[model samples]
Target: MSDDDAERPLKRHKPQHEHQETNVTEIERSPDFWFDDGNIVLQAGPTQFRVAKSMLSRHSSVFRDMFSLPNPTSESTVEGCPVVVLAGDTNTDWKHLLAVMYPAICYDLTKPNIMTVISVLRLSKKYDLPAFRKESIRRLRGDLPSKLEDFRKLPVAGWLYLGEVSDVQLSRTIALAKELCLWSILPAAFYGLIESIFNHDGSYRPVGLSLADEISLLKGYARLTRLNTEAPNRAWLEAESPCVPCDDCLFRTLCRSRCASLRSTLQAQQAGPGAVFSGWDENWSDEFCGPCIKAAKEAYNDKQLEIWKQLPSFFGLPDWEELRKMDLDAGE
Candidate 1:
């Protein structure tokens, strides 16, 4: 990067390691409105609240209704109150993706104090708030795979996203689950994800394992792959078999069955003595069908007609059939 780019200032709502004063001044002084813990304060406006701790109360309701909020009573407020704040760097790419599914994460928390929701997520576990922790984990994990680029770019957010996933998104999730491990999983974890995805029709079918369970397996497998000294590419278990073995090997058989083009190459090799493996042409595209495209367009127009009818009605309009006839006449 140029020197000019390097000097750009980083901005964030929650200050970084530099701790600033946490004070709540009363716009209209009232004892009941003040929260004793210095971490949060109420801000009032000329005619309304510029901001308020009452915003946190909204987080409290969502915390409660997750259907598992720990304590329901107003007296339970202190323990249930959000106790930590987690913020990602301001320049995150996938914050767009995060915001797309924000409603699910923060429940019904309003716009003013989103950091409160993030803070609740980050510290819920540390403070023994099981319900909030679970909610946070669920939200983070749900968006984990799609936001991998974002996670990797923002190390702090990535670490938190990783910690959230390291236990639940194992090899199985890596393989059969959407391409979550597209970037990388340790080789064994790579194989495991392959096994999971390929073995079960490429859907990460849930087999009653908790998210935590899946992540634990991925972490364990990652550790194992790291310690092994062997090169992943050169380590082929199928190499011991004869070049043209008649032996019934399950691995070889499965590989051959799933890959039709490879089988065709094998047949070509057998037919020509002393032949080397010639790779099949990879340049074929699905043959386009003019009729199918036309049919699809018609179906799409029909669907659009339904959507247009549902919208506010025009006082007078030509029927669709009449519009088509007009087009035909115009062409003629």
Candidate 2:
């Protein structure tokens, strides 16, 4: 950069210039990423992280290209290190990704913190760090898979393997997916979200949920409920081609009785096709007659797969393959 620009004063929410570095009382040094010998400063809003240039350039092609240039804006410095202003990336995300990269030789990416994984994902995508991005996507899809068989492996109510997978968390994931175009996780995320919506005591909206998402959730819920009430998915209810249970079939009696009861009665059934047909209550199925059990399992396999297949559409999304094609992670 021109010496004129190099001498430019620090602007609002930026690190101080080298000549007046002591005036940086306004800037907060990142607790996680600051290093005494670090050669570059990354300004994430008012926070400054003193980190190595070569290290970042190694993982990030963007960083490589960036550091290759004489200097990119911020026109400020901490110590002798030139500060690069990060307009959109948050300090928390930068810290999270940098923490993984620095100080530690190896850290487990499996069962990663959902928020950390998400941050890494965002930063990785922005910075063109393919390894971190790929791993983040892997961790995300491990819990929320595109394939039905993989999703079935999670607990009946536990559609997502991430801790708790609360309504708030699901909404956050959906928001992230929308933000980053992470389409593959949407079908299962929407499926899990519908259960929470159904169980709410009238107030279904979570904070930060966009109007578009709120509408989609409600619409998807309605469609899913309609599907469950129809043949195939709800075939166990025996609305059509009613099954005359054999004398010893206790499940025949329980299933009929449960159908009339509140959703609170059968926790798994409350989720309808997604949970129930994953063979959640295999022992419960054992109570039915041979022919009845066979039919129910068939319905479970066929209808659950069908329900999974339609989950994306219920939320106004394209099919899984098409959704994959829409993602940044697609085709790799």
Best candidate, TM-score-wise?
A: 2
Candidate 1: tens digits of C-alpha lDDT, residues 78-165:
2123222212212121232123223345565433222333444433322234555455434433333222233224332223332333
Give the TM-score of each candidate. 0.22, 0.78
Q: What TM-score would you give candidate 1 relative to the actual structure?
A: 0.22
**What stretches of model 1 exceed 4 Å from their correct place?**
1-55, 61-120, 123-132, 139-238, 241-332
What lDDT score belongs to each candidate, Candidate 1 first? 0.30, 0.69
Root mean square deviation (Cα) for candidate 1: 22.6
Residue-level lDDT tens digits of model 2 in 170-279? 78889999778899998778777766655533345564578898888878877766665453535554544444243345566765554434223443443453333345
